[model samples]
Target: MTTPNESPKDKPSSKQMICENESSTTKKNDEGDNVGGGVESVDGQNMSIDDANETGIDDPKGQGSSSRKRGSTIDVAIQIGSGSGSGSNARKKREMEIPRGEPTCYVCSKNFTSWKAVFGHLKSHQRETPGALPPPTFTPTEGSPENNNDDETNPREQLAPTLLNLALETMQKMSEDSNMSVVHRPSSAFNSPFWTTNSGAPVWNNNSSLTVGARAFFTKPGGANFDRERIPERVVHARGASAKGFFEVTHDISHLTCADFLRGPGVQTPLIGNFDLVGNNFPVFFIRDGMKFPDMVHALKPSPKSHIQENWRILDFFSHHPESLHMFTFLFDDIGILQDYRHMDGSGVHTYTLINKTGKEHYVKFHWKPTCGVKNLLEDEAITVGGANHSHATQDLSDSIAAGNYPEWKLFIQVMDPADEDRFDFDPLDVTKTWPEDILPLQPVGQMVLSKNIDNFFAENEQLAFCPSIIVPANAPKCVYHNNHHEGFMNFMHRDEEVNYFSSRFDPARHAEKYPIPTAICSGKRDKCIIEKENNFKQPGERYRSFAPDRQERFVKRWIEALSDPRVTYEIRSIWVSYWSQTDKSLGQKLSSCLSVRPSY
Candidate 1:
């Protein structure tokens, strides 16, 4: 090895060098394939055996030149320093040297004259026994500086090219063994294996919390990166899996909406690093009004005191909201418990208004019909499956994609003319009711294919939030309206403008031209009450009737199980029985007979 301060001429010239050659041993394995016991040329390149032995490069195989293991070689070639070359490549090689440490191998406790020589030695060890040990978990002791951190006593002038290659390969191996990744920090970028409290100030020790003087749990006033460790979980649809795919436009509905993503036929909307069609398994929501959103979530969530979800508590809360009865039709059905995310249908529960470029408004509901057809786990199956593996759903989706069996869904939309809103007995806007498929046929729009699985659960699924709110409409014919109100908790938008509000000269956001405003009149005193046309029982009854007798029996059995809860109030049971009677007398009578109670109504 040549020192940095040494003159190029002091190093042996190319003519004076001779390469040592080593031949690898090969033998046929049990599988009748020739396996080399020594290094083989990578990428089918014609590599000189002499070049390999001279550089002391151990082949990835567990064999090398006998002289390498013994550290004795006389036919080594000398290489000129990186200074011999011009441009950034030379500078990069020079920068790779260990800045201030003695060229020492922490693993073998071997010291070399230069960083390059040390790295070459390390590479030989790695190639000899790949994956024999993990990367250094403990930080190596810092070497005392000989002078200022920049000065070095050793010269690194000879075999610079070979040594640089060895250094890079060894460093790469270290990164792989350590499971390191590049992360952007505020001060400077660095390689890390785990996420810190914040990227800017990394928590070198993540196993323990930041404490005061290593005794108390109180974090150092500003030292601990514990201020913002978590983002609020979504109010609903919190548990879900997301995927990457594209939404292609099959048919043009330019007259319906002006959404840029649906501009024309054959238009594709990329879901990765872009927008997502966040939806649930069922086609409708528990509440139509956003005001009831919080209360509805509270009722569905585990009880505040016990932290356990009880059907009795859920029933008591939703007993008053008859509108929820319709949603329960699907929720209690066999499909309520899915085998996995891919097996169910997705829906944009709310009835959204789609305005065309001509300012004509139409009410549309988005639907995703799974190409696999709807399949649900039976109640007993759900218990057995969930008991076996809570992450079975997530695993199934991942495994399917890995096996090249990409899940697909066909997109369809139900359109209703705003003028025909009151044509049906049920409210068109009621989320609890699904428009009769016979009346409003599902018009084909497009299809979506979940082709890619997310890389990180927390970074992708946990952090991902979608709102019917985050819409972007262009001047395209099918451009749709944008509604973005629920912006809180882990909102990851970086805005750098003075005015955050809209309609300003400096602001870019503004209402689009020819956007149709709903003409429905709003002339009512402020009141808090259920929707007047809450015909929730009718839909549930229809849904119950649509099911086969066996399916209906299962549905009633589920209801009976819920009504039999020890904590369920008699009044609540009576009210529920009365509601079921309104939907179907037979269904009501069956529940009453099972519960040993007379029909309330």
Candidate 2:
């Protein structure tokens, strides 16, 4: 019988015999034959070809159906292939295991089966000395074995040319358009055109102010045109600074909310923000629900008779609504007199819902934290700053942007699951309350950077209006308003049924027709409209308790002094006593003791 290693023209070489021995120690080879002959076993016994068949062990070499004894030792001569011995074997093994395909480099066009080979090739192409040769041009390798161009045009190259041609054609067409050259007439000088009455009739030669022969008959310009240049200031947020900025989302909260703005990172929405401290940081107030908003503003505003704001008027108006006490704590605190707009924080001051793509609604509250951190000026600082410049905040915002030092505010929202709203110590939907960051953590949404200053104060800043109703891509879930009849007539009368139409009509199919419906529909619910019921009082109470015992005493003393004012009525003082009692019983007792009055139930 012919042996496996025996060739047609050559006797089996010693190296071949050793290889056959090594193969017999392994599994069967390619052909069905036993080829083991030479090679010493571990026990110093040479494995012979007959030993493989005698032991009845399965073929050790994968080449053939030969069998050998287990643990048999074999000696084999090592053979070198065409290239590096071990390295060439490894390459052959990998090539056989890994399917062959065209090689491509992601970074550079240099292609090689091994990246190390590509690296060596790249180094050789580089000039040895600095500036010794021109930069290697990335020419399209054509007809070289490396280039595999199957068609006349490369798809990417063809796309580039087509886009360039289309762009050029668009530019040429735009150049020929008549609208491109249209000119708009600019407004003439204010007084040179002769200031006119509201009727538009010119009032010429007004140097003497409508005088009778150099003797002034009418002192003012014209009674009718005198007040034309002036308009009524905003009822609230009257003293404020306006800034333009973009709200960019930095967090991925798509799972917790359906609001498009908080869906992912890098989404930006245009915003015009206003900061005010007519009496508090939280302007555009959400008092005891939406009904009390107009009334609260009316009470806080300057009296119609004196045209001067009096603390007595505000205290009396809010006294009936005991919930106003929570807000009063903030308004009475040092934060009420922030020296400049930059130092104060902003809050939505209402509970809103975050709807996710799955239609899950989570109660949420928006907060704006200054990147510079909270720094409030004391009463003395406010007196000095306000006296020095009434427009200090506006000037600061404008100058900061111009100097390339933009002011930034990080936007965060405290979210609570709707089912867990009642689990908190305070109501989440109450406008009079504030969320405690310790319990319900503040999740960062994004940042607002005021980089650009408005060009026209009147056209851009003054005329711009912002309502809580505006819904952008990232707004929270919708809200419903409900009212109790026990609320006063002023409050109950304002329970806007037309506004809270969503709850009445549960059909979402009708939503498209009412897509742009104003937020006016849901304005009457007290808990939903007022202090965000979730996370409100706990934060204030913690803030109050954080003060040293002595400081807390001083705070109660100050409150008592304010409440004990002779102008403040007994009922108002009693209401305040109860309010502080709810905040801290000891605080209320101390205040009542200082006022020299028994604590009212």
Candidate 3:
């Protein structure tokens, strides 16, 4: 209870305080309001079990005064429910009594176990609220009567130190709850503004709330929205950095595609680039089929059991998918670890059909070559750079844009006729294989310039969204379209129409010119099997042979390091050696010699 040995009849009916054999005189503030609503206490029988159980509202504004109330009583009511010592087994269990003294609410005689909860509860009280002395934040100075003998001073003087301690505790808790760094800065001149209670109308009321305003968390319309402030992240490209810029068409591609942005030369499209494409980094992937993506991610990510990225798990997964060897050429190469965002090359990796105005289809692959040229740090340099700061690339890109030193990339595309698809030794549709640049040369299409650094980090990066139906916001789409299947979650469109559908008469919307969509006459059975021409070894072998002597040695060293994983058994190691042998006999020989495993080849 707030205080003991006070009038039981004075407490609010909600408390239901039960007192026995105690005459309590209800203490009052200087303004004459009863402390704890006239609650009383007894020596051993004024058990405040009700105080510990019944609690009032907790206010986030953090009410209660820093200074102690001029007139207050120090009556603590504590209890431990007990029963007869000897009885039946169930009765004996009930006989045990645990003390629940904890601090009581000075405002309403409610008891709480934790001092943090007590201080947090105190936030509900307003300064003007009756009997809200709040817990103190510190002891009175050494010379104050608080340091004197307990009998020499009244309980109010003794109560000052306890109240001060609680206030200190509550402030510290509020600091943590607000998620503010505790670092002290000499140059900082920041102070918290007064808390708003009723909507956005700044006020000091703890109990008041506007119908559609900022109120307490428990209130109907308060900070509930803040609780769900996080925008969802992309499942795959969750980690990303982006900048705003423009992609200008550098050459005419109107003959190849009817797309608006690529219609003519010198046309620019505002673009946002989020380059956290793990698979995109290498221009090739471990698996050819999109269906294997889930397993690929699982192998690359931490193991389900150990929660560590184990080489054995990755090798084992790739062992079953031999087509991954082509990708391994770049993965273990010297330039595998990117230097930074600005000096990197990118590719579409997948073949997509581009339809012309006449409905002629040509499978195309887009490539990005940095205007600054390809730059790669050696393994040691990369180690040092990453150890210093993992976000070094993001910082570099943002800083470059901010300093007016824009990073630029030239866009190029390779197109092939559908009739020539069967002429290739390797499956052109396989993402694990790259189109030969000599045969299908890259045609320069555009140049992308990242001139502007993002303004809002969350809005630009974390909250970035992608949908098949919607492009990046504010970027003018030369082709007009509508989201006919509209109005679901997060639908913020302002429309008075009751119908949202294609060709709806009730709410008519204009249709854009019909764009040519690709279609093909098919005669094959739908089945899950590797592509017929799975020539997984040729490209990887050619790539390995192209690397210089030391570069080949570095690639072999990386493979040895990966194969040294204790969990990578002899069978899995041999499986890898077989893939390496098929890729390049010399590469496989080096691995077998170093790993001492027989080659499956």
Clashes of each: 15, 41, 15
- Candidate order by lDDT, decreasing, is 3, 1, 2
User: Could you tell me the TM-score of candidate 2?
Assistant: 0.49
Candidate 3 C-alpha lDDT tens digits along 1-601: 4345434355433212322112233332233222232231211112232222221211112353333222323333333211222222131111111111225555675766443345456656633443335453443544235365443222322332444343433233323332222322212322237654344455454322222211111223344343243347443556668888898998998988897778899887776532221227677888875555555777887777778989989998898888888888887897788888898998888787788898898888888999898778878998899899988989899889989999999888999998999889987877889999999999999998998877877766665556544544433333444655456754544546667666777767776778887555534433333456889899999999999999999999999999999998999999999889988999999999999998986
Which structure among the candidates has the greatest lDDT?
Answer: 3
Off by over 4 Å in 2: 1-231, 258-260, 272-286, 468-542
- Please identify model 1 stretches exceeding 4 Å from their true place: 1-232, 272-278, 471-526
lDDT of 1 by residue, 474-531 (tens): 2111334333433564334443446645566665566656555645444543333444
Q: Sorted by TM-score, highest first, which candidate order results?
A: 3, 1, 2
**Model 1: lDDT to the true structure:** 0.60
Candidate 2 residue lDDT tens string, 1-601:
1246544354332212122223323344343322244331211112222232322223223454343223222122222222211122321111101111122332355555432243334334332422222222333344321364443212221212222222223223223443322322213312345666556777553322332321112334344333232366765565656666777889888887655556689988665522221223562243544434555667887887899887778778877666665665666665666756676788877677666665666788888888987777666788888899888888987888889878888878888877786677766655666766788898888898888787777656555544455321112212332323334522313343344334344433233322222132222322111233433234456667777776665567567667766788877787777667667777777777777665567
